[model samples]
Target: MSTQINTIPASEAVRSAEERIASYDWQEFATELSGYGCAVLPKILTPEECKEIAALYPHEEHFRSHIHMARHGFGKGEYRYFKYPLPDLIGGLRTALYPHLADVANEWNARMGIDQRYPAEHKDFLKQCHDAGQTRPTPLLLQYVPGDFNCLHQDLYGDLAFPLQIAFLLSEPGEDFTGGEFVLTEQRPRMQSRAEVVPLRQGDAVAFAVHNRPVQGTKGNYRVNLRHGVSRVRSGQRHTVGIIFHDAK
Candidate 1:
């Protein structure tokens, strides 16, 4: 007997992604980002959609490069960066999510006293990255089995860095994985580092700062540095898809 796999058409996938993205209360998302440096966009993808994306992990044709975290001292497990002409669902999410993120990113840059601003569209921003010779795609699929974890680190790839990115949990927390939690750390000037463990369910996406974000201080807005990673997986398997707006050099 043979099992059949279901897939969404490119047009339908893009439409679904756009419609779901449009339904969110972005003002609340922006507020959350301003206060915490991260915000959850719950159930942005359906469980079946999550499974479809995760199922692409072992296919070599879909990716540009593969990375083993341990070889780079980036902790354990492995990941693969997608090539240009990204899979429709991933590409759709990337295109649909950027404008909203750009608004928040531009505001953060202003508050942090950084002069950089992102373009209003994802394609225009990619053009900037490409013109600067950072042409490699940044979106990736990560897989971790038991005993794997990631180190806290920023996702900056080139001289031009987008302030925010998103990661979707493609596996169910309790059933498909265990003990591997999404973690973010913030370091404020002249103070201790603060850690936050974000709880996520299957198909949920978390948007977060890629490097620096502004925090309101008694005097004025001050910049805080942030790094994100994952805790060790105690049992089962886990998968995630990351959407980074800027390309790599």
Candidate 2:
């Protein structure tokens, strides 16, 4: 069973998000970032932007899966995040988007008085990671394998920073697949679950922190940290375009 969202296009969503971000004031946006270390900007990218990215890659019939899990659940998450294959796409994205994303990241850093702001250097770091990759959630991508899933985990990649990442949901998620839901949960001593079965549409995106308490589970614990993962796609395939920001080493 797979649920499809006949929503807007990717390019349109990206354009819209770009427009919104362009006008967004860092001072005000910081409130949400401080609360949950993330915020959801709707219509982030239009369907067309999604297509433009897909068009760049010629070898896209390779939709596969990878099964990953954790202590929380059985069906954690599935891969096949983006149309571009690994390594190449990873380097391309780092080179292409890093420079452009720098201006915005710097603004956010300056406004927040963050100690780290190294978009240009980070681009080079990612380029070097084309072959050697790690699980710290850098500017790398993972392919999806049937019956495979991702488990809840924290994205601890660098020393410290704000707005650590901005991921693009290339696939429209829904209940059509058995699992494959974007389950985001807060981790506090209380262990409450503030999870949303958010299967963001292909043109939409949700950004979060590398470490923050999940809204529900953060009562008793001190900085329990936000954890998210995929639930597993029993039926169809899932795709995504993920980009992570980091401080230079």
User: Who wins the TM-score comparison?
Assistant: 1
lDDT of 1 by residue, 1-249 (tens): 111123668788678789999999999999998899999999998998788888888888889999999999999999999997788888889999999999999999998888898999999999999999999999999999999999999999999899999999999988998999999999989999999999999999999999998999999999999999999999999999999999999
Query: Whole-model lDDT for model 2 versus the true structure?
Result: 0.50
Superposition error at 11 for model 1 (Å): 3.9
Query: What is the C-alpha local distance difference test score of each model?
Result: 0.93, 0.50
RMSD of each: 1.9, 8.2
- Candidate 1 ranges with C-alpha deviation above 4 Å: 1-9
**Which portions of model 2 show Cα errors greater than 4 Å?**
1-20, 23-29, 52-137, 142-146, 158-163, 174-179, 190-196, 213-222, 247-249
Candidate 1: deviation at residue 117, Å? 1.1
Candidate No. with top lDDT: 1
Shift of residue 245 alpha carbon in model 2, Å: 0.9
TM-score of each: 0.96, 0.54
